[model samples]
Target: MCSPFTSLSSPTKAPSLEVVDLWFRYPRSSEWVLRGVSLRLYPGEVALIVGASGSGKTTLLRSITSVGRWIYGGELRGRVLLGGIPLEDLPLDGVRRSIQVVNQNPYTHFIEHLVGRDLLSAAVHLYGKELGRRVFARITTALKLEGLLGRRFFELSGGQLRRVAVAKALLWDPKVLVLDEPLMWLDDEGVADVVEAVRVARSLGKAVLIFEHRFARLLHLADSVYLLRGGILHSVEQDFVKKVQRSLRLSRHPQGGSGGRTTGRPLLLAEDLWFRYDKQGDWILRSLSLEVVEGVATVVYGTNGSGKSTLLKILSGYLKPSRGRLELRSRAVYVPQNVYLFFTEESVAKEFEVACRSRNLGRLCVERGVSYLRALGVDVDLEESPFNLSWGQAVRLAVAVATAASEGPAVLLLDEPFTGLTYLERLQLAESLVKLGNTYVITTSNSENLALVPSARVFKLVEGSLE
Candidate 1:
């Protein structure tokens, strides 16, 4: 079989990027995250790096951009060459002009509150006002971001944020582009838009490197695929997707239905629900009504910016309905899309202890917490800081903490909980949710996640109404 990393023919032009015998570790850390990793990306090619969470994919990207040395406070020993010149020897301004990176967290790139100003600021800073406007106009039209320019950054949905981040990076017209989890937070249509943007970049002879957990959707567009594991990189065949599929298969537990009491009546009810962020603003949800029964899983599905998250917030009592009636039989533990917001404790164990203490389940806290973490397939050290966990691990930890808080029967609301998770991680989460046997209300844009609860009452949210 041909290696995915092998180029069709040696390019006449110099390679856009070259990593030779790279080795790196975080400050004061004895273990190296990347060891002797080497790769070459020529102009007009799209390369993909796939790995499980915490497998150093993000670390490799940071190393290429020299962010590890300056911002992340990491020690590095190796050479990163760009355009036939070593990165350390290149001027800072020259490096910045030649390479543009879009981070995994889009929120970190926002400098202006409004979308148009945020995008314009970067363009103007780089190319000056007159030329920047032309560049912004061209890129926004290409990415179909014209409609979002007038909105506030906070008002944009997850998919919109991802698009804007890509557009911002492309507006600079760098020689190399790096995107971390670019396909995340996007719906099917949004994914197509990003894929097209990548194609356009390659057509312009720019090198592109993407770090993604879900690469099946982008496989056809990638010129090469590399798997990062145990601080090493290896080329893998496209057929490796079969392995990912097998990992995603849901497990059938013998005791799955034994604990669930599905005969109970509805625990939460919504009638004539209507909501909007502002009085004059467009209604996000209108005349939406639903019933959630105990021991039953419920999924709300919609496209990007379709108010799925908004509905979850309303159901969880975080946002008041402008006009509606809502009845809850018990308290709810709501976990937002950004799970980090719910964390207050320094460490995972402490967070679990606090949750147990709040519910007066003192003696059982440690035992229950460890059990929950195991169920979620989280193997991180309990003493490690919660912030230190990767995105996928942190999300699983948040779910475990939320479940622990609901000592008795309660409603568990999770918004986009499967954002950064791998296929196996998601499968583990599904099994854990089934065992919990609580009334679960999950909102997601991914159709794949709907299968997590086969028996879930699925509802589609369209144009402010549920169907």
Candidate 2:
């Protein structure tokens, strides 16, 4: 066995991206999110930072990218170097010229409504207009984003949005590329596209640093793997990926309902469902039909842009189908992929109280919500703002708020509910859903969803129709 950080001492080579004794915490926070973290990424190499949800992986990226300092106004200590130059010494624009970042939420990366215009504008702003167009064309083609060029940014699927963000980052052609959860929300094809993009970046001698929990897809691309836990960075051999995957495997719960779906009276039914954002746009849900039965979990599996979310939105009454017959017997509450949309109240306690009160469940139900949040590993302060919670914590909190009502069984429409959750957290959620006595329709692009809820009735959404 050899030290994973041995390359840091190599005398002849300088790291393209380097962090030395870095420490950071949010403003007015006593707990340090990152403590003495040190790592070096060399040109032509891919470095991976792995951690569970809320383990400060995003915070680490923020620190490395200087967002934690200037924008976030956090207490920071330690140095981050780009091309052997201290990041503090470099102007913000100078740093941006060398480093490009793709955020975990792809929507935050775009400013324009049209995908093509956003990419072209960003590239032109970074480079000259003439050179930017050429770069945009090359990057878009490489990422297979030609079809998405004319599409509205918000209408793109999560996977498509991620691909566009990657292409946008590549347009900068910076010395270092930083991606946060780049593989998330992607189907097999989209995953391959992003993987290839990272490979190409490495081939072009660009240093790449990826923060991801989905190690299975990107482990092979990593030149070094570091685990971030409890504000500390620990080097782990890439072989540990197998152990990580194994740990993520769920032990079959006696209540688990995946392969053997129990069917009862149909709670919701859709016939010949058709939907699109606009009349001229392509149909997202083309003649799609679905039947969700009472007292059983329904899983809709599809690629990122396969209209799964669209279907969920329709079922939840957030959107109406362009043409279809829909009969929803029970009330449907939707928890979107972006869990932040679920939070309307300022504090966690207030949100819980309002949700419970809406169903006449009283303050007791609010206490139950807090207990439920703790069971899901959130343990958030009731007075704290829900917006401050981590993505995983927010998911747990939102689901708790949605289901804490005592007003009988309702249809739970969860869009990628397991997205940001750890394996244990997901397992807890799946088990909770099984016992909640609610009809649930969970949409996801990951096959692991089937394993998590074996009793779920699975439907494959392909080319806009359920198969």
Candidate 3:
């Protein structure tokens, strides 16, 4: 992806939270994740940091918190200041209360039952009090998570879980909040609520920093934003404009060619599948039946835990339904949640070629832009190590390998394929999918993202049913 990449311009002014001349290396890792990278954040400002997965966005956040211990072993250098004071020199407990972190995946922060425990636990840890419960209820209710007060931690939907996390953060009332890609599993409304919450924090003169890739809804909320390119932060003057441009590019990827798929029998089929995380429990998908024809794009959508990922995994043969008949005539190439790593001496391109040929997809990998690296704004690092590639690059490589190796009208299924890509990278990926035309069934959280695809039949999984 580097060859055709045009250099981006640097911002003229320093950010509010100045990070200067920082160098870090995670223990046991010979390579440096961030080298001589510097960034800044303005006070009472919401800054969006965009970068491919493992590009050091997470590292940058961890370092800011002075929680370098969370990272195996990393050497900290240069100056990190908050309100013009060295962050490292500040007291540990003071730092924790000042710069708060709401990380990815709410499950990571799960603790105790009942939402009232949110502030109670923090207060108890600090001063031992029953008063925190009432305080928690008030704040949680204000955040719109009141309905989930008595609900178990694991019982919340993805968005609800994320809300609980935010409410906890708000209850603690830190001066600065660091939300790392907070929109991971949130729906349209959830995204809006979280944005408003961030704005509220800013209203109180708190600094809010958001790291994310899906800016479809975040274009307006943030006051200032920048792209964290390979740990080098680049400010986006008009994120609002970038968001609009991104939408236009996505609109072109799928429909560039006229709609209409060739008539063909269903290559994969499922009938009346009913299952749940636990038996004797309410089923997530009930009597669900779906079909995918050869050489066409089929997108699946549903609320979080509405069986979208479950159904995709079942279709991929990774999980067998508790009770149902599932069949697939062609080899299925699945892009799972995380890209798989291989212990071998293979370049990205070479590895993709080998994987495709091993699966009899060598032809597809070669014919389409699979093996071909992007130039002039296209990627071309297929010859590099899979472990060395960024999350976005890895996703592309996996998709490329899947397409190349499958036989017949191979069933291609992607579960949240755009998870870590920037809006621009997503456009490029969506365009590549359009190039794969037919033979793909993609599942995504949002429907507007479908606008990027010209004519994908949007089938939804609502309460365990599809149409």
Candidate 4:
């Protein structure tokens, strides 16, 4: 069944599978992302496609939907049929009614001030008036979003927004659901929630396809696995899923790093820190105090919007604390959330060299940059614009550039470092981070999901205070 994967010019059976030599390239990109890719989807089947940065998993999903209708440059070479009818000939709206795509960035979907406004309003617009309050409640509860229906949109964090988008998509009940990096910001429990959602859809005989970099929680959930690389599809068995964890690891946790010691002095200290966005509102960080001792990796774990990122920002001097004394043992360098900004330069590699030289640590930071970039697989055209690479490549490059700025054991506050990274890239990065002698304070929802890092100590942000 794995060999000689066939395509369909026309599909008529229950397991309607049809795609003939599909090819596509995004308007923003000059290089081809997908090359003659073909695959079949059976009813009630789940497919998990994994790939490194620039591997083209996302393009496959879009080609099926012809999302490039907004652009007129891409060349379409093949036929895509569902139940034996050509998709290209069908009305675009009719095709869309059968397939739904959840974008990688949900911020594009936010328009209203409150969660109910965004979701419920969408339901009314899509289904036409008279969706009873009871029906909406039932739908929200099915997606585990009942508690969030009334919350303000600005109040909802990244993870919360992701779930809200998911709930809204489920209301459509399309024949196929395409999720792009669905588990990026979810905690272990939240991951479980998404898994259950997929399971429910599968049980209803809907075709479920997921695109993710990390497959630790997703490997077993899929009936078939596929790897997207170099514009090709390699149908793989479950064995391919398990090897991903090790294959991507430059070195696993216990074996990672040169075992540097970082406890001589404090890099940053927070004493009775109180912070809030609004002067009249409750403090996001309530009387929180912490220290980043040298040569250690301190992990901060908390539910959505619990001040993990807030505290990291305050300690890094990105956001000044509202009250209480704060001190930095050394200069701090922060990696911001929108990491793509770092890739604007003409020469990606030269940017690192320039940053290191500007710091004038001159040698230590420079050497770290050389080794770290190699470990993170930053081996593209150094002279090209950084935005030319894929999302995962951009994320890893951001990590390399930010870490190269270190000057004498400074504090590094990483806010969700593994945003779009694949398992191998993440493991290699975890190795590089553990080896850094500087103190690290990372804010994450699922710190253990990586399973490849050795977090020194974990902190919990409960209601606003870090305990």
lDDT of each: 0.80, 0.80, 0.68, 0.68
Best by TM-score: 1
Per-residue lDDT over 44-86 for candidate 1, one digit per residue giving the tens place of the 0 to 100 score: 9899888987789988988988888888899988899988889
Question: Which regions of candidate 3 fall more than 4 Å away from where they truly are?
Answer: 1-44, 53-56, 68-79, 110-115, 127-138, 185-193, 230-232, 239-265, 269-283, 286-289, 313-329, 339-390, 393-405, 436-438
Please write out the lDDT profile of model 3 over residues 382-433, one tens digit for every residue.
5567777766666666666665555547787887776656777777777777
lDDT of 2 by residue, 1-467 (tens): 22211211223367889899999999999999999999998888899888886678888888877888899999889989988989888898878867889887889888889999999998888668897777777677666788999999878766677778877777766678898888776776767767877876776567899988766667778888898998899999756766755544543222454333355888788999999999899999998888888887888888877898889999989899999899988778999899899889989999988888888788789888788777666776789999998776787788778877645667889899887665666777777666556688998887665678776777789899887
TM-score of each: 0.78, 0.75, 0.73, 0.76
Per-residue lDDT over 15-106 for candidate 4, one digit per residue giving the tens place of the 0 to 100 score? 44466787777667777778887877776788888887668876677677776543455666677775456777768776765666677776
Return whichever of 3 and 4 wins on TM-score: 4
lDDT of 2 at 197: 73
Residue ranges of candidate 2 with Cα displaced over 4 Å: 1-12, 24-33, 65-79, 86-94, 105-173, 184-189, 245-266, 269-289, 313-331, 343-389, 401-406, 435-437
Give the clashing residue pairs of candidate 2, or none.
257-454, 257-455, 257-456, 258-453, 258-454, 258-455, 258-456, 259-454
Error of 1 at 307 (Å): 3.0
Q: Give candidate 3's whole-model lDDT.
A: 0.68
Where's the lowest-lDDT run of ten residues in candidate 3? 1-10
Lowest summed-lDDT stretch of 10 residues in model 4?
1-10
